[model samples]
Target: GSDGSPQWGTSAEDRDPPGGDRSNHTACPKQRTVHKCELLHVAIVCAGHNASRDVVTLVKSILFHRKNPLHFHFITDSVAHQILQTLFQSWMVPSVHVSFYNADDLKPEVSWIPNKHYSGIYGLMKLTLTKALPSNLSKVIVLDTDITFATDIAELWAVFGKFSEKQVIGLVENQSDWYLGNLWKNHKPWPALGRGFNTGVILLLLDRLRHLGWEQMWRLTAERELMNMLSTSLADQDIFNAVIKQDPSLVYRLPCFWNVQLSDHTRSEQCYTELSDLKVIHWNSPKKLRVKNKHVEFFRNLYLTFLEYDGNLLRRELFGCVRLTVTLPPTLQQALEELDEDDPCYDFRQQHLMQHRIHLFFLQYEFLALPNPTDVTLVAQLSMDRLQMLEAICKHWAGPISLALYMSDAEAQQFLRYAQASEVLSARRNVAYHIVYKEGQFYPINLLRNVALANTQTPYVFLTDIDFLPMYGLYDYLRNSIQQLELPQRKAALIVPAFETLHYRLTFPKSKAELLSMLDMGSLYTFRYHVWPKGHAPTDYAKWRTATVPYRVAWQPDFEPYVVVRRDCPKYDQRFVGFGWNKVSHIMELDAQEYELLVLPNAFMIHMPHAPSFDISKFRLSAGYRGCLQTLREEFHQDLSRRYGAAALKYLTAERSL
Candidate 1:
């Protein structure tokens, strides 16, 4: 076989090309087995032992959901044949008949074919189906192993009737723009070929394919460098497209829901909603098959359930219903337990955010349940480098604690891994980590804050950052302050000044009294009293809240740290990106809305010392972000002009009531 000689293969009498045949349906021979009564005939080409389980699971999914009789034909290697034989016998599902052919038999005929532009050996195997399958089968559905039928095989079979006389194949068009655009660029003559079809699902008329001798067309593409010139790894797909361009009427386009590609999230405009009538879901991307995100995890777990299906009572129950409830294997169970809860909020928020078509992508973290019922959810955004800071904050903040940790896309997985390993943090399931922005992109502080706030379920939320460590008893003080403000009908914000350590020695102060020793005696700053009230705006650092007790003042847009507000309060304006004027802009918005900003006399946090230059210039905002900030500045000025008539800009400084 390896010597490149022609092998024995089937040949049909009808010798017309594909589109020229309209009356060859009855030319196919009749079947010799009882499977001829089945209404659905599905064929799959699996390569080796690696895809053996995938093929078995796909077959199980089809058999589990179909009410009509079905027959399956598999073209695979010897190892897979052994695996499927054992799998079918163990499942005890006998209404179906599976006929397997050794794919090696076709190799002698295609052995001389070079794999220069070959995607995979499986692609080579697909081209042999016309000769390997029974001549009696007139129509069949070919599917990729890495897919599941969400609906019924009968529905997919119904698409065959919709195919016109000249349409020999029914398929779903590839909704991806990248592939279509590249195809257009390379093959400029066929700009009107339309979006090419994905070969994942196909309704084929085997008789027509054989009558037209279409296998030669596929072989010709490989021999003539038609696909090689295009530099496409999709060997079979390229050949199919080459033929489709010659005869556009040879394909019947099906709805995209029939072959929903999961990683095509970027092509959301072409994707179907969850509520749509989906018949098949193709896990086309190999990256997702490795289990990187929740969407992949969702499909992976379902695939596992299908693989281990034993036709037991639970399997029978799942056969009637699409859902299943079964205990996971011990090793997989432990692995998943180390992750966060499978929160549906990730899916819901993804759909919500993508509607805006913002460049931002959502990351999924496993969620831990709230440690204990508390009135507030403490939230912050940080990277993996700040684990020590987070641990220290968690040790000092003593209250019913629930946290939402937001990180960029690059470090979210690493930080989550660390959190899962930490005994002190993972001891309770309360923190939710969100990947709110792309890896290494300009950190959209306002957008992260809004995501954290929207996900917070508590009545009050304490918004702060990672580097700031709360002083002892700060949480208790805030909890008490919130109770006192409950009776007031007006919205309020509890503000606390943040102090930074002069050096690393003072960074880990042994006690609250030791840290408090640095605060000035007469409400004035000293060398040790490093009260940095700077939050993207100039602050009167010499002044202090000398009321000697908690008191309310007219709100000012200056403080950014240790602010506790009701959950119903307006959220931060997300348009302001980078470092300058973010939290202060929110404060100004609240001031204009007449919400009181309360100053707590004794409450403060010790900011951890880091590298030099913790200023606005340190964060170089991208050009896009600078543009966004400019737009916000204009909006703020326009609002001011509307309120105070041109001189309102001067009143920005005059309005500080504290």
Candidate 2:
């Protein structure tokens, strides 16, 4: 039926045999039944964890036994409990992956303190071979997940007869010095079978791994300090070497074509051209293809291409609970049951809440956490809140908010200089104070009001950018205005001092639609972040850049939102932590159906300007960058690459209009 080959396609279903259900993402092949998948199933055990998840997933799906290609699994102790198991029942996990096993379960024959680490891992590897390996498996190859097959594994199996029948095996020779031992004759070897080998690519025989002295040899060797296991006493591999050298009849030294060891990959991001000629590609420490943001982004896109239920599953994992089932050994199960359900947790809720929110966007600053409220400073929100009526219309958008403070650090000499240079703010009688500094804040409207409720003692403290200028002197005008009201009784957070700006960004056309758009009639600001193009003022790098930000006038609510505080008020809730300040916006959540906005008439202000430069491509919505990816999308779950480096996008949505 087919005229071409799907050389690059990795879908297990596409390759599954005839009469098998190929409808589901899971392919059930009726052909190739002679091999039975359960037999060809291979598991790779790794002591290192830089790469495993996604790579293994692709290999498993592609090489999975439709008629039984092989069900490949990777074992490691590094997986976190909440990562894959907690998110989905779909079974396939994200990242370079393999089936998991904890090295902590391996027990030592002699009673010495057993670690849950490297030494413990050898025991687990032995246990896996002793317990699960199928009896009929001609030779079970335990390889590193970094392995990429140059050719189909059938070729590797074809050569099995080349070596005498055996269960455990490894690549025979090494061209490099073993990190564990020196190969030169100057070094003495007591039990080592021969020179040490690179542990990266191993072809394991379950029976040979379960040989008479394997566990004993590993235990005696691992008992001493790990450093002592050099040439004189090799760890797991050393034991294998000793055993193999004594009995080459049990193990065969395969040629370089079988297991190729790579020297360095850090210099480049890729190297498969030379590798294409290999049968089983073994990645020793896979640095280039390790799982990270790219891996997450790949899976994120797959949801749209492959699964119809993508978003639903994401929401469920984020907001709901997942069920997990594990088959533990009888003794292990009993030990876990003895402990109370909550005994291991000191305060699970608190830790979970904090850890979960760390990934949310609004958590990277101190202002968002409301660290201090008593450090009294004027709080001003540079946002659109004109008439009280318009202010009420803009309260519905739930977006992020950011806060910043402007503190003028002036010396006693500068205070004297400022009095003559700018008369807008001057020394008051009996206010004998040397200029330590004058301070202020720019908060989102929600936080501005919150800070005001706590800072009532500062009689003259109010919200206004330095742009708040008036003929009567900006500070005097505000101080006089606050004195006229009963501060405690009315409790107005801030006396409104919104000023009109003199500068804005002129819009240029990138496209016809946005180019024709104009600033609304009588509205202020076209571009944002611009400094006073004409002022020689106190300059901070932060202050200097505040000018020249792009701004546009659009439909926004306006309300008389001012700064108010009682000096003892708590810090503001910092849910908003980036930009955008909508006035009287926080109060709308309360029932401020209609509150009149008091405008400072005939006044003007210019927001500090900063130029805009952005590159949107940096935030690609790939699997590794999107929301969490624990399991593969069931729809495209079948399309895993042999190397599983990239997700293949399968669906394209045409423009609804075009």
Candidate 3:
């Protein structure tokens, strides 16, 4: 069978002799032929009680591209069988057969294959297929559930014909040699650079692997010391690398585009330029299933698009509860099973992603209703350095906005000139740009804030930084909430917290709600507000929402960056000229006036991703910071002394700005 001869010839006329010896391969009809193009056998492992939905999605993606005929044998657990059966039955085609084989049923054969690690045990399920699957399955293309086929899977099956006499498996090479780096210390024969592959995608010669003694490979995994030596972060990947290393001739490396993983993205930029030619995309990273962010959703949506579920009712019926469910292995599955949904440590980011996709589904039809877009004005103070962010901010928001840009020296003015000439300002007529020229590297931020405040004509003003993006329906909701408040409550300052995204890019394709889907809810924390009891602000929107009147602001400081206030509220203290202690001084003044600070429920601005602008060491030594401290003492000391006596001024320099 190792000889370069087709076990089942392509022609319908090819036949084996009647009652011929069938010991070498699985016994089939003695006079039967299989046209390779007409039928294909694809085996996918979804063991360790993983999600059935993802496997269904993978199958749908494969079926979308291939029209001829397909037989997909799924190796999974009993828990997933019912769902898989229900899903595949609905998607069944005339020439396709969807079959499931529980990995537990094959336990007797692989009993010698030690369950050293759960991941390694799960990986061994693929090896058991030769004994577990029907004997007629000689050549099977194995795939991980995380993969989606972009090209017809029949094309991938054809790669089997390209294999040499010695080649027992067909797989794309690993994008990098990072996986093989450990073999250097063991003095083992490592795969050549770019020859190692992620086991996410593989075309296995099941009959040959059986002939080559799959039981012996089982014994190799059972050895404790050897398993420890072979162990990597990815337990199974390391073992597979060693197997291929011992017998490199057994594998035939296909083109890189066949199994493109995240690591493969480092290939020439031309790979993306020629994306249409890509056959398969494997999201082999564990995070791909756990973290449901925009990047992960991008590929998932591509798979879903090809699935092409008809009508909104059908889409909701299928994916309503199934969205964000992942096919996790044993370790993660156990961990997730142990954690409650409401627990502080529990991860619900994926659920948020599902909500966003559902939101996008609704966003397709309904017109966004804004009560009065002209009544409220968004005021932002920014330095000229973040001009692109300013442009993006304006483009994202539909209503009128005011930008107070502090130009620090000639370079900033030059940037302004470039922005003026460019489409940044010209395309958006509702945006009002107010440039304040100053002569230093550190622009006068507090002065800029006051300038922006002075320029706003609206009765209600939302003061925020240039990078913060308001969530969808915020404008309409704010308008309705403001209208509901009593005359005295209307004068209150609406406090909204800012949540930061852990990204560096300034652009987003989706709305703020969609972007919020990417953030881990457990990791979401508010910015530090100095004047709060614990030096970090905590929002209690429940008190404000349920109370008859606006929630009273007694001691809480107003961090003005994401607060909406009446036009007549106290302005930002211009005396505190630089970054530190500027916004809090204004907040302290608002608190001094006893203006109510109502924390709006379920509404907040998202901070666009960006690195800190100032270097800490240099900023501490700068004249701006030095002058800021003196100005802070002079301005805050008087207010602190008058408001709560001279004793309160003790914290003036002792507790510096964060």
Candidate 4:
């Protein structure tokens, strides 16, 4: 064991052999035997808005150098989780699998340990690694989001095998003199061993750490150290070193090349003699690539190479066939079941957190070629049946369209073929299709809307349904109205009057004047005029007929008219899934936020008739479905009251009183 050979463990002989089911095979075979490559497990604690990009570049670097497959455990918040899931799903790298654990789940474990680091609680999440990861995972390589690998990750994974019997972690020594208390006179730092250890890159023997009761050990060390130090300035790193200071045998020292620290005060020269020997580059400073180091340019260039690398080239044959059905994990399913049925939005919240297999930005052939500054983007969601309408919408708008399409695997393949054959859909380059595969019987309409809205790249977004045909030149009219009216400076939504006609063969209206003519002729009626008059009554179509300019409209109950608003407006609530209240809930939220809804005199949208959706049909036929919808509606109003105060719900209260 002292000769540096791998020490599997004291009970290594009791474990099964490396190759599986060797009992049936002869001692030697004629052909060379191929052994399946073991998956390299890696964990990263990535939180905040800007961490997704850094983590993506880090993962790309690992995939570039490692020949074997990888399994990534991302301890992230909701924002980073959604972004990363969309990216990795679309990238479709054959050798990569990603699982996300909510950072909030581990907050209780480290919340007691006060941290002064900018990352705060997220930085301390690493201390709960033994509890955060699955129990089956015995070993994992944990890396900081600010690192890029220059060598195969397998070489780093191999370090775990070299850990001595008493060692539970493998890490590089800190390449700085801050711990020596010599930076300034009377400097005091958290207790640490000689030079301490850098946690930027770690080989965590999770099984061993769990056996050693890591949670209690770290807590005791932190509690004792906090008494004298007041608080930890370096988060998990400080506690890790403190624990090691008590027992040095708990850590195995990794080579300096594995973590070339690039902090402004780093003394890396003492650990490495040449740049060529560096296996990993760690920009451990807040300044990142801009940190002041002797070899800053070299390290910066290495990080940029991975940053600019083409992710498409790293694509390979998918690891497995597309799953026909996506079953919610037991944890998610139990969470959903335990939700208060009376809480209308609980399911919606769960759906947002649910790990559904999504492929984002699936096809965007002309996204990059479009002009940089577009005025408005059409954001909508649809199923495969709506594929035929894209050509017409794209040709009419002739601007940007961020679409979320829900379909099965078979339907997606069919739609791809359909897009290739149609000239309008194929030649146009400004549309982005984000595919959300089928999950359950109910369609996640609001989730689709959020996906489309989130991906819109324009300054303003025209939120509408895919079944509506915009009045000709609507895009230009809205763009000119926005500038002429100065809508951007104010909290406003430019409402486009919507109409519906039963006659499908009639020529679509091109101008507001012609639309009024049809209105007079009794061919087209205001959308849902008879069944759901309140839905569009707030737009005041009677006044819109004579008004020549944009007019402000008061927020009214059940108002869900289509509108053009800023890209950063409040998102649709995912709880109002199925039929009924999805769009109405969003309208209510906008009202609560005090957004002025202004009716545009020139622009309009006409609905094209189509068969009812499955959700709508269920709502009509099943009393249980209708009851659920009513319960959700009440809960949503209560939520709005709580979020924006009772003043925000005055309209609803007034309507009920009437």
Among all candidates shown, the one with the greatest lDDT: 4
What's the TM-score of each model vs. the native?
A: 0.43, 0.36, 0.39, 0.55
- Candidate 1: clashing pairs of residues: 340-366, 341-367
Off by over 4 Å in 2: 1-39, 46-49, 52-69, 78-99, 107-128, 131-139, 157-170, 177-198, 207-214, 217-235, 264-276, 283-658
lDDT minimum window of 10 residues, candidate 3: 355-364
Comparing candidate 1 with candidate 4, which one achieves the higher lDDT? 4
Error of 3 at 639 (Å): 86
Better of 1 and 4 by TM-score: 4
Candidate 2 per-residue lDDT over residues 115-150, each given as its tens digit: 333334342353345454455544555554455554
Show where candidate 1 strays beyond 4 Å.
1-374, 398-410, 439-441, 505-513, 520-547, 554-561, 612-631, 640-658
Question: Candidate 3, which segments miss by more than 4 Å at Cα?
Answer: 1-37, 48-50, 107-120, 182-195, 221-232, 263-273, 289-301, 307-658
Q: lDDT by residue for model 4 over 1-658, one digit each (tens)?
A: 2233343332435233577556755673222211225577899998754576577678879888775667899999876776677777645567678899999999999898889988789989999999999998998999999999998787777666556689999999999887877889888888788888989999999999999999999999999999999888888999999999999999999989999998878888666788878899898887786777777788888997887565555655423344222344678688777877576545545554544445555553344445434389999999987787898788678778999898764566577768778888878767887777666557789989998999877889999999898987888888899888887678898899999988877688777888899999999999999788999998999999999988899987788999999999998987777788899889888988998889988788988888888778878998877777777777777888888986766855855775
RMSD, one per candidate, in order: 22.6, 21.9, 23.3, 15.7
**lDDT: worst 10-residue window of model 1:** 355-364
- Model 1, residue 267: displacement in angstroms? 39
Ranking by TM-score: 4, 1, 3, 2
- lDDT of model 4 at residue 175? 93
What pairs collide in candidate 3?
174-196
Write the residue-wise lDDT of candidate 1 on 1-658 in tens digits: 1123332112332233466564754564221121112357888887554476456557767876775556678887765665565444434343455778887887775656544442365566666778888998888999988888776677677566556678887877776654455635554321225667778888888898888887886676556653335444554565577677777888888888888766543352345656345567777666546633345565666665665453332123222322222244566556545543464223222222221111111222233354222367676765445667767777887443433343432344356567668877666444544444242233556666776676666677787777777777777777776777672455777776666655565544454345455554332232224333445122222343344555665543454445787777777765465566667676766666566767667667666766533324444534544554555566665675686564455444543433
Steric clash count of candidate 1: 2
